[model samples]
Structure formats: structure tokens, C-alpha cells
Target: MSNTGKSLSDQAVQELVAKLKQAIATGTYQPGEWLKQIDVERSYNVNRFTVRSALSELHSNGFLQHVPYKGYRVTEHSLQERIAITEARELIECAAAARVIANMDSPGLQRLESLALEFRDALNAEDRPRMMKVNFAFHRCFNDYCRNPHLSRMVDELRERGVGNANRGWTKRSTQEASAQDHLDMVEALRDKNLVRLQALIHIHLNRWRQGYDSLSS
Candidate 1:
């Protein structure tokens, strides 16, 4: 393949990886569900090489587990593992709150607020997939302000790892409402440049899903 051909192939693989990750995160692919390469090829209409590469990438990212003969399956975390991930998020996101606030300008703040409202609208419309997408966009915009690409990438990876388990809590209407409010309140904190309040809100928001998961488990 030429360099341009390889580039297109790489892009195709990355896109496939993202789509598969979203499917897993949204429960379209249940935990422990096997993902056969041939089935993926048929469903996605991609070549076998692309399917293999995409699956390999997801496996490296902790989104899938590979078995020699049986193929790949979505990874499932236990309660304890999920709690550890939540704590990691709190530590990183709360610590980064000040930086996030410092980097925000009026336009950036408006974008954040807009995304927050969009998330609420999705929630009100009971569009679970849209809600999830907007919620992710809201956070991604917020994290971009930290001005540390490596740190932002880590946050994204951690979020993807825990989203599957956290989604269980997101099913509750009350939990969803609280989360929507949390996003707006977070934007308010950014506008006011209240670092402490922002950190507190971040902690609370991160724990909301954990609380829901706990309630369900108990």
C-alpha cells in the first residue's frame, strides 16, 4: 500500500474502534459478549485486517479481552474495580479543576454552558444515546481547558473504562436529573472562577454514578 492508502486504512481502523467502543459503553454490546472478527467484519462491512487492528486497539485500551480461540469479549469490571476507577477520576479531575477554570474564556464558557443545556434537553427527551454523547462532549470541552493533552487523554481513557458500569446508574430518572444539574452547576463554578466549588462539584458528580451502582448492587 502507498502512504496515502495506509493513512486511509489507519483512519478506517480508528473509526471502527471508536464505534465499537461507543457500542460497548452504551450497552449495545453487553459485558462479556463475544465479538467475533468475522461477525464484526460482516456487521461493519470492513476488511478482516481492519477488524483485527480495531479489536487489538480496543483490547490494548482495556475495553476488550482477547481469548486465543474464542475471540474478544467486552470487559466487565467488578464493583471494587469500578470504585477504584471512580476514585482515580476524582483525584485527576478535581486536581485539574483550577487549571480548567484558569484556561476558560467567555466563549469557552459559553460553549460549555451550551453543551450542558443540550445534555439536559437530551435527558428531558429521554434520548439516552444523545444524552450520553452530549454529556461526553461537555466533559471533553471542560477537560480540554486543562491544556495538557496527555492528562486529557488519560481522563478520556479512564472515563471509557468505567462508562459501562456507570451506565447502570444512569438509568434512573432521578440520577439523570441530578447529573444534568451537576453539569450546569459546574459551568456556573467555571463562570465564577470558583476553584474550590468546582472541585467539590466535580467530586459529587463523579460519585453520583458510584452511588447509583452501589444502590443497585445492594
Candidate 2:
């Protein structure tokens, strides 16, 4: 543990950013709502400097928008931007899934199986939060073998937004079963080294996510 008044690990930074992004996505901090430095400092139990640093990092990454005198606001996405996100996810995730299928390892398979079970449990319990966690875990399970950290990181950043968006979608027990089954299919595909099926399944998974987003506005 390095001492520097407040030394944050990469994981810690990601968690903090995820929390803030979740807040923004869930309307806790509306699109136009001012993200006060003091409020985040007190709420998150950190100093204004940390808040500023985190916010700056997110802003630079296109998750937050800095207003001239009104503090920061969550960045809003248009339908076009949403579609672009979907397309980008399809390309990256499918490519990663292909790689995972091509270079399947025992550890990766074990991790994917574990994540699939977690997703099933979350789905059975109809727990959106847990399901969200499991869903990302499942994606990362395969993405870890991608051999391209930068691509994997991009998928992760996009997924933070994807999960937030998904939170607003209908996550009833019935919906949960379908989503969970999708995860299982993806895992099975990867485990069998079915590249074509894995790619298609990954594309469908992302399309479903985007469909949920589209349903909101319509």
C-alpha cells in the first residue's frame, strides 16, 4: 500500500467512476443537473480534489460534460450516438469473442462457466444489480483472453454505459430467463470453440441491449 495521502488503485478508480456513472444514468444526477463538487465529496466520502480528478477523468472519457459555471452534467446520448455505440460494441465484442473461441483456455472456460452460473442465480433472484454485475463479469471473462488490453478497456467503458442503460429496461423474471439463457448460450458457444455461433450470439446480445435502449424513447 503506497502512501500518498490518497493513493487510488486502478480498480478503485474504475469503481468510483462506475458509481458516478451509475448515478448519472439512473437520473440521480440528471442530464442537466449540476454535479456539485461538494456534494460528491461528501456523498462519496472523499475530498473535492478526488471528486474533481474523477470527474475530469470521466469528462475526458465522454461520460460527463463540464459546464462553464454550472459544474458537470452527465453526458446525454442521442439515438444516433446510441446506434453507434451498438455498432461499436458489436464489432469489438464479436471480435473478442472470436479470439476467445479461437484460443480457449481451461482457466478462461472455468471463469466463463462461473460467471454464467452467477448470471443464472442473479436472474433467478430477479436482481437487477446482481444481474448487471454478472453480465459484465461474463463479458470480461471472455474479454480477458482478447490479447488486446486497449480493446478490452474500450468494451468495459462502453459496458458501464450499457449497464446503466439496462437498469432502466424491464428486468422481470421472464425477461431474466431469456437474458440468462443468452449468457449460457454465449458461454457454450465459446466453450465449444464455435466461432461463427459465438460471433452471432454476441451480436444478438448487443442488439438486445440496444433494443432495450430504443424502447425507452418510443
Candidate 3:
């Protein structure tokens, strides 16, 4: 369906994709779990065509896989792949933070602050899903100010592929309280418009995850 005349089509697709992505991130789909289109349609309360479209979108975005006879499943990434994804994301986000500080207006700054607050609240509440959502939102706010549409789009796609791997696998050792502290420090850096500190904070953020993953492996 085209977005031209549809008021809710885009909204519905985004909502459904978020829900499904969250489920996958939290292991609801599990490794190698095959997802039937009919089951997804019923569970999401969307039409068959909508379900198909959403699934296709997810697949194209590296969140889902198709097996010739086995249907669709959540795609899995190896630790090495996860590390690469995290590194790439850090590059984009850290640079984006610097650019945003140099470009975005007051209103844009407020939006970034709002996202950081929401992420902190989610961490305080120990809500993993909410934390992930708002954490991504904060990065997105920075990336939106990147001024390059292609760069913004690439960061978003990388985020989708990295969210589950980053949040679930790489951060298993980071408690909610610890993550909250990290978010607070990041917000403080952003509020001060300290690009150097912002870059450092993002490095710490990703390094913590890498440490956690390495610890798990050892």
C-alpha cells in the first residue's frame, strides 16, 4: 500500500515493526524460531498484506531471515559481527553528536534532552524495552542533525541490526542502575555541549558493552 492517501498506514507499520523488533530483542522469537505470517497477522491484529509488508521491511533491514522451506525467523549475529556493528555505530553517533552541537537549534537540543531523560527514566524503572527505545531515540536525535540524509538512514539501519545484539548480548552484565549512571553522564555532557566529552561518553558506552561481551566469552 502506498503512503500517499493512507493516514495510518505508515504509523501502523512503524508500530508493528517496533513491537516485533522488541520481541525479537528480548528473545521472544528465540534463536532460529520460524515465524509464520498468519501467526504474526493475528498477533499484531493487522491484515495479511500489512504483515507481509512489515516482514519484508524487517528482512530488508537485517532483522529477519527467510529459509526456503522454513519461513521467516529472527536473524542472528555472531559476536564478531556484533562488535563490528557496535564500532560502526559509535563512529556515526559520536560524529553525529559533534555535528549536532555545531548545527542544531534550541528546539533540537531540547528534543535530545527529552530523549535522554526518557532513557534515564526507563533505566531507573528497570524497563529494558523502554530503555532501548529511548536510548535509540537519543542517538537518532543526534543523527537527525547530521545534515546528510544518507548518513542518517545508514545509522538507523545499523541501529536496528545492532539493538538486539547490543542490548541483549553485549550488555548482559550491565545492571539497570549502572546504565542509568551512564545515561546521566551522557546527558550532562550533551547539556554542556562538550563534544570531546560526548565522544568520550559514547566510547565508554560501547566499551562497557565490549567488556561485558568479552567477559562472557572468557
Best by lDDT: 1
Query: Using TM-score as the measure, which candidate wins?
Result: 1
Cα deviation of 49, candidate 1, in Å: 0.8
The better-scoring model by TM-score among 2 and 3 is: 2
Misplaced by over 4 Å in model 2 are 1-34, 166-175, 213-218
Per-prediction RMSD in angstroms?
2.3, 4.2, 3.8
TM-score of every model? Answer: 0.90, 0.78, 0.76
Candidate 3 lDDT, tens digit per residue, 1-218?
Answer: 46664758777787888788767755466545778999998888998767877888888877998878777888888878878987898887887777766777778767867877787777667676677667666767777887888898788777667656555543453544555567667667766888899798787776555545556545
TM-score of 3: 0.76
Model 1 regions more than 4 Å off: 1-7, 214-218
Q: What is the Cα-based TM-score of model 1?
A: 0.90
**With candidate 2 superimposed using the best TM-score fit, by how many Å does residue 69's alpha carbon deviate from the native?**
3.9
Residue-level lDDT for 78 in candidate 3: 82
By TM-score, the candidates rank as 1, 2, 3
Q: What local lDDT does model 2 show for residue 141?
A: 67
Model 2: lDDT of residue 77: 68
- State the displacement of the C-alpha of residue 121, model 1, in Å, after optimal TM-score superposition: 1.1
Clashing pairs in 1: none
